[model samples]
Target chain A: MSNNNALAARVRGTVHVIGAGLLGASVGLGLRERGVDVTLEDQSPTTVALAADYGAGRLRTAQDPEPALVVVATPPDVTADVIERALTTYPNAVVTDVASVKLAPYLELLRRGLDLKNYVGSHPMAGRERGGAIMARADLFVARPWVICRDHETPAEALALVEDVALDLGATPLEMTPEEHDRSVGLVSHLPQVVSSLLAARLIPASEQAVGLAGAGLRDTTRIASSDPELWVQILGANRAPVVELLDAFGKDLASFADALRDPEQTGAKRRIADLLSSGNRGVARIPGKHGSSERFTSIMVLIDDTPGQLGRLLTELGELGINMEDLRLEHSPGAQIGFAEIAVLPEVAERAVTDLVERGWRTL
Target chain B: MSNNNALAARVRGTVHVIGAGLLGASVGLGLRERGVDVTLEDQSPTTVALAADYGAGRLRTAQDPEPALVVVATPPDVTADVIERALTTYPNAVVTDVASVKLAPYLELLRRGLDLKNYVGSHPMAGRERGGAIMARADLFVARPWVICRDHETPAEALALVEDVALDLGATPLEMTPEEHDRSVGLVSHLPQVVSSLLAARLIPASEQAVGLAGAGLRDTTRIASSDPELWVQILGANRAPVVELLDAFGKDLASFADALRDPEQTGAKRRIADLLSSGNRGVARIPGKHGSSERFTSIMVLIDDTPGQLGRLLTELGELGINMEDLRLEHSPGAQIGFAEIAVLPEVAERAVTDLVERGWRTL
Candidate 1:
């Protein structure tokens, strides 16, 4: 007992990251990078071997010694079973699970009479369109939000360990209930995927020529549509309640928009379009600016020619003007003579940047 | 007259692109890059002078000699009047207008008994989130489609000149009636903006803490929501009818989805989500692969660490593998131990690249 306290005081125990998939392997790799001893495991021996081979973690078998913390990184469908098994298998270790949706697993654990004291539920608000262990990276959690859904019964030590892991991974931790996490994710993540996919689906029957004319707008709107169907099926399935509620409200707005369009005289159509478009303005205002600040961006337009090196020239000129571009976009019409380059800058720098560009003999509109 | 025909025979007369904004300046720049003699005009002396300064075209005043073709590149609300004025001012010149919506101006021209023989209506399927003449580029239309709406009365010479213009700008030309063009754009362009804006609007009421946690999924879904409100307001206002119709259909689907969510036990909800998701799958299928081909992309996942040089190393290694990356994405979660890196390559080369990476001791999941 004295030795245990001594070890805990000097260093956190080895972290055992289970599954060796994107999240699991990343956890192991990140902990290892932080000088924490990490052991990686997976149901598939080949996967476990591959993960270790890639330096995510050292391999650990079921019979291996218990570690200080255990992270169950698996699909939502199986997270609960994995967590229960981990708890039973490593009674001395603090346990956690990183899954997209939370309520179901938490409920399942309660039903199974698992020790709630050792387990903290977490959802890392980061992911790519691809999946699997191969996609794991040590810095995946850096600067992103990690939500910890804590219950009253969660042990303080376990919570502290998890927080330490999150901090070590360079993540900003937020605290919320399982329900709040589910609802928030439903609105921000799951609903957007559904909407994007639906919009993309509309193009299925489009003529090759029409589809060919697609620009960055369609690409951006449908990017999430390319996500794996099976995984999303599970995600949407688990978060159906909140997702459904959000979709319903969206439907009302869409219906109102449609009604306005169908008006014979355009009076109602203009109002509807105005309302919808204005709503977007308001919505955009709510988004945090780059680097988590809320400051609005000022857009400046620069005229560019339809020639090679022109864009490079403009960017170089902007660099020379000392304009730190927040965002940049280009507008071109097929068979048109010129292209428009729109650059977003911090609101404060917008006027100076515009004046500098104008003085440099570049058109600013 | 002989000199005019001679010039028209060997080389097209100078195409004057008016307004020099995103659309107008692009037209001039595109033609000039194709070695066509082009003149640019705009009401604002500063804008006209800037276009000349950028080499998009030479500045021409109202008193200047007419060109063979004149493109009225202006805002939608003002396009018809410009077209009418251009026709009157340049009686010998063939005329066209580049606007987002079509039916309104065509109708207005027809009602005013303008010289339809010299004029055609066109909408280029290209744009950026930003606006204005200064953002113009010469190759913005490269490989994109330009839709030209023509009636029986459109002069053959006028149509030919417009087609030449589109080709010169490196755009594919498509012919359609005004109604067809409006309906098509309504589905592909206008509807997507409304949906995106509506989705973004939901974020307005969300807690700042939650908004700060957003990742690329939310960003992609809401990117277009940051579009210029004044310009969109004009586009939406003009194309209300068809946009409304599409939104109604979307609303119906959304309602069905909501019903399914309200009762999870019902297969209806499962089917709804599945159907919506599947629709996205089908829609994604319609998008052209990289390099404007229809081939499927092969996706590969690689594990990366959070260190500064880790991503660069992976990319460099992939380059060493002789694998050309078509697209790449990274997912970073705040307060987590790892991240994900997804890469897309040609389908035929996927396995070879994956094997090479694995041999190089990189994790493949």
Candidate 2:
């Protein structure tokens, strides 16, 4: 108890958190679990105090020594100001902000001509549908990508400290330039967000019967449309350059596809449409699923009858066979006692699993 | 065994299947299971023979009586010709073709001045990534929507015959006019397919690093992009009018959204973006999940340690608690022994589940 814990030893002195919202509070809780002393500050005293009560950290005071590191987890619009203030106030401490966009704030700081050697910009690819200090959890950042932006002039020690924090929170730290980070996120995160929002927005004017006919396709495409708009506006605004470019490019693709589909007889129209759709097939195949090497997972269709008893027994037998079911999707007809379950498992065991199930008198597709 | 099965009682006389492909072979397989006399026909003799050997149906013989009902399950482009051939040959039989696009083929048959009373247009909204006789399942249509178009002049018995076939195959039969069906499918299915394909096509030029950062959102939005291009061309071509209109409307939505995102300083620009996103929220809320009433499902996030034992024990306790998990999403960082498992359950039990989990020494978000 007298000695410093593993993380506390390297993270000397108090690690001050300047914003006690979801990201800030989560960072405090995660670090505190590693036995580091965390000091909390927020614009709203009640919010900061609530975070403290929840074991995030206690409020900082004048008597406390200058912190070794300060984490600015404020909203994206105010990130540059917060970082500047932290650097000005704590002259000796390292400063970092968990802003989604890395370039805007970095450029703003550069424009101010402040000595920003201590500042490191980072963004954690993790969030929930709702945002608040109450929604924060110690394990929130675990297994997520935490992108760390570094400059050529930055000292190696400052970069290491931020990476250490990310690792301590159980996140994989990826290093990228601010430009690369913004562009990459614009493609993977911001672009998808805008597209999903637009797709779901189309549903507003649809008839109940039309919406009722919606299957997994529409649902999956629009799931992220539930994200808070105000928060997105801030993120998208900060990364407007890359996001606008991506949206424009995506729009052109949409236009060409529609044109081809509109007049399929206009020489090469059908081929053009097929070529674009085939590109989509190749593009989708590149994404990594939950297991990382997602291509390794294969789905086997198993026939099922209306009797509920068979489902229970099938699950039991899968477990008995030592098959770790990756995912399961069931198709059951309403008022009809027939359907099939599409089960996903590792490919190495897929054939064997099918054979074993068939030997036990199960039908597969 | 000598007597007709439950379904065969209503579906009297021989049922003839045309095309002997995924949909047609599946129809035969399902009807044969009910002891209905089913005969197979296809342009390709080898294909028909393969389907027959698979026990879908036997080849129609010269001595056999005319089929009571004929099902045409050809490609959308050839659907009209096949339906015409079936109607011309089986003059007295009730004829229905399972084509994805209803209006175009229906109009084509009407142009030929064929007898209007005996033909019903239907579509089964069920398919696999790949289509063939081998991929056909007896329960392929189970629990899915089967849209049937009927005109005022059609006989009730002809409509009932088509509906009965859908029911026997474990599908829910829905009645809609050709225009309504075409427009509804354009909104629910075709529009999303084009959007998803175009969104993913943009990824073909994306950097490997950017693609590597892809998450569940990107994957979900692009999943359907892997669909067969040839099949989509035929479906889109057959339903071009409605689909083109939808795509054009969706393009306008994208343009306005991009303009708002591009010029945030413009009056109401930010508000416009927010409103669109908020509309998306409302739109997504209306989609039904696997259980039909998707709103009933609430996800509970549970914190898990790096230890493998904790997961096993968690599953055991969940079973012990009699909590039926609707879905599970695990967020685990590679090389980091910490993550959270998001467990979805019915909302009625969510509170009890959290309480029980906490009492059992499990931490939940």
Candidate 3:
């Protein structure tokens, strides 16, 4: 490997990645791009070979030296075992695992009476709906949060090594305790997953006519319910406590909301409904904007044809018009020939942007 | 008004709109554009004048001939009252309404023992998130579903007149009983709205760190929770029974899902969770596509900078390459300088489209 990246010099030896799935392979691909030597392994030889062919990393060989860092990127169910194995095999190396749930595996390692001073539990908050080596991307972690769970007993060098890998892969490293990581994800990820699934599940028994009335709102609300259930089963099981608490609290809220609407003639029923909905508005507003703060941008919708280069041209014209696009979203119906390009820009430029586009024979909505 | 549309000719005289809000103004604009005689009215003089200035229609005058049709486009709370008044004021003209809830008004009028032969309950399932005349578009109802509810005593001419206006406004007319319309909307629209609002409301008490970890799933699921709570309260109250029933059933489903996750070690617990989630997939799949069927498409993600014209150029190139896009969605992270344009294409052509895009220096994921 070419020794080009100063960041990779922190690790003196090869970095071995186990599992070779989407997350593992992506880590390998990213590290390799930085001119770091990476070795790949998986339970399935075919999977490892596929990752290798995809340039994620070369397969681990006997001739390879003991890696300075070992990354375990297996499924949640097997994460603890693999982390234990990696630590036992590479006593000289600092070990880390990129598992979504943090507390379970960490507890499991502790329960096994293993010395885990060198093992750091980390998770890159990045993934697509699907998984596997073939779907791995070197830039998957770019600008995304990568959480590192460390103990008080862990050495500073060990923590620095894991964080270096994260930075080298273009991920923003965040230090959190295992408990904190579990609780946060339980609220942000697992709770939403279960709620969305339950919401969509109600549709299963709906009449076709009812489903026919489904619009963009329903589509957006239930979009994530289509995620792989088997994978979710393992995730939810591993992170059961926080998710269960979230679900219980959410269920209480759902019950109260329904009760208020059911007998709206009751005193304060309407007020309750309005207060809850308004709280939703405030809650959603608190989510960090695409650039991470609470800043708001105005969006202008431009109509475009589905034919190629049309959107490109519109975007190009906006460029020529000196409009800086803060964000851009293309929306098309399932079978409509026309699509909408919703471009976000500074609020001050919104009126002028629409006028300029309209003057240029572009339809702005 | 000049005679141009044969559908407008079905009503030989002027069409009077009883409100100047978004739907009322849109109906007026659409009818006026098609050379139909349109007269507008509103409790708010300023609102009526604004709609008129936008070319929706002129204000009604004492000297004007009796309208051929009266459209009650008032708020849901006032719909029944306005419909009753319109029926009494113009005994010869057929009366129809464009309120979202149908049965509530129909029953209210029936309970008053008013003659119902000329009354038609209609709803145009088209609206922007925001309301008022400024958001009204002449083509707002184009390709959207417009439902008409008729009673046993409703004259054929009354039904035809309502259907004609729906057709003239470029909507597909769907005939249903008031009960059916209420039930259908309860399942598809009302249920989802309440569920989403409640889900988002849970976030109000969540820690900032949890909200910071939110992804597209959380965003998508709660996007509509920002809707006007005042309007939703009226709609839900007017259609209380169906919505209440739907919400109750949905609440039960959420509880069961949580229970299953809480005890996955029990017999069939994991399987039950999987089944419910998988059912969500089947349910979402059952939703009619934009063109009115359930068809699936493949999506390709292309990376673009937040710069000008880059997206337009890529789209133009896709058109040049003869790749027909089925749907397009743009995704970006807050604080990230880059965005992703996800384009949908036919499954058969997806591979070639990706290849062609990559060859043209576009990154496809």
Candidate 4:
């Protein structure tokens, strides 16, 4: 391997990645891109070989020198065992696991009373809808959060090694305790997953006509319901306490919201319903601007023909008009010759942008 | 006035629109585009004049003839009263409404024991995030499903008149009973709104760290939660029964999911959780393609610099490659110099498309 890439300058030895599935393969591919040697291992021989064939890494062998870092990217259920095994196999290396829930595996390791000074727990808040070696990408972690659980006892050198990997892979690393990490993900990730799943599940029994009325709102609220069930089961099981509490609290909110709406004639019922919904406005505003673009930006829809480059030309025209796009979305109906390119810009520029586009012989609806 | 527009060729007289809000002004604008004579009215003098100034329609005058059709586009709470007033004021005209809820207003008008042969209830199933005449678009209803309520007493001419309006505005009209309309929207629209709101409201108490970890999943699930609270409260109250029932069912689903996770060691508990999640997969599949792009398309993210025309150049290159896009989304970090253009294409061509793009010197992830 060439030593010219950036990571090779900092990483002293090979980085061994365990369980060459989506995350592990992605890690290997990204490290290899940075000229660091990587060794792949997985229980499934086919998966490991496939990842290696895709240039993620070469197969691990005894002749290879002991790695400087071992990343355990197994599923949550097997994470603790794999972390323990990796630490034993790579005795001189700093070990880190990329499991979604940090607390359970860390607790299991502590229960065994192993020498854990070299082990770190981290989770990159990044994933695709599907998981496998073929589904992996070198830039999967780009511009996403990678939470690293650090304790006072952890060595500074070990922490730096893990954070460096995140930084090299284009991820921002944030430090949190295992307990805090679990609780935070429970609120933001697990609870939303369950809620979206249940909401989508409601559509299973709906009439075709009802389902046909589905719009962007229903689609947005249920998009994540399509995640892998088996993977979610393991994740929810590992983070049971916080997830359970969140679900229960959410259940109470749903109940009260329903109660207020069911008999809105009650004196305070209408006020309660409005207040709860208003809280949604406030809570959604708390999400960063990109994540809450609908509230923060104005969308102007432009109509275009079915030909290729029509949309590209439209965006280029917007640039020529000096309209700084906050976000852009293109939607096409299968049988329709026309499509909608909904460009979101700051509310201030919207009217003038529309006037400019229309003046320039473009249709801004 | 040009008599050559499409609606002018078919209609007998002017279309009078009551309530110059988002829906009202949009109906007027779309009809005017088709050369229909549209007269606008609103309780607020400023609103009526504003709609007229925006070319949505002309202000109604005492000297005008009775309209051929009266469209009541007021808020749901005032829909029944507006319909009743329109029916009385324009006795010779066919009266219809564009309120989201159908059953409430229809039932209220029926209970009053007035002649109802001229009234038709319809909902265009279209809206923008913010509502006002300023947000009105002539093409807002294009390609959307507009639900029209019909009954034994509803004359064929009245139904035809309402359906013609829907068709003239480029909407696909579907017929259903009032009960069916309410129930269908209850499952697909109202229920999802309440759930999304409550879920987003949960974020109000979350720490900054938790909100900072938010990803596209959380953002998609909470985007609609920013809708106006006052508008939703009235809509929810008007369609209380179905929405309340749906919420109760969803609450039970949430509770049982937590119960399964709370004791997964129990027999079938893990299966229960997995079954719920799998059901979600099936349910989301029920939504049509335009609303459910995640399931139907493969997303390929491409990196681009902040320079103007860089993204446009990338998309224009895709046109040359002959790869048809299913959908496109662009995301930009406010302070970052880079942006991601996530293009969704058919799964069959994804691998070749990526290879071709990489060969062309584009960085894709």
Best by the lDDT measure: 4
CAPRI docking class of candidate 1: acceptable
User: Considering TM-score, which of the candidate structures 2 and 3 is the better prediction for this target?
Assistant: 3
Each model's TM-score, in the order given?
Answer: 0.82, 0.93, 0.97, 0.95
Clashes counted in candidate 4 amount to 0
Candidate 4 achieves a global lDDT of 0.86
- Stretch of 10 with least lDDT, candidate 3 chain B: B1-10
In order of lDDT, best first, we have 4, 3, 2, 1
| lDDT of candidate 3 over A283-324, digit per residue (tens) | 677777788886778978787766667776887788889888
Error of 4 at A53 (Å): 2.6
Q: Pairs clashing in candidate 4?
A: none
Candidate 3 A-chain TM-score:
0.95
Q: Please state the i-RMS of candidate 3.
A: 1.8
Q: Give the CA lDDT, 0 to 100, for residue A6 in model 4.
A: 53
Clashes of 1: 40
Q: What TM-score does chain A of model 2 get? A: 0.90
lDDT of 1 by residue, B1-365 (tens): 44334434544567888888877887777666666677887888888887777778997657666788888888888998999998998898888888989998888988998768888888777655345667777766666678998998887877877887786667778998898888888777788888999898888778776676677788778888878777887887788777877887777767776777667687566776777788888887776654665556787867655443454456667665667666555543433234556777788999998889889888755
lDDT for every model?
Answer: 0.76, 0.84, 0.84, 0.86
- lDDT at residue A329 of model 2 (Cα atoms): 59
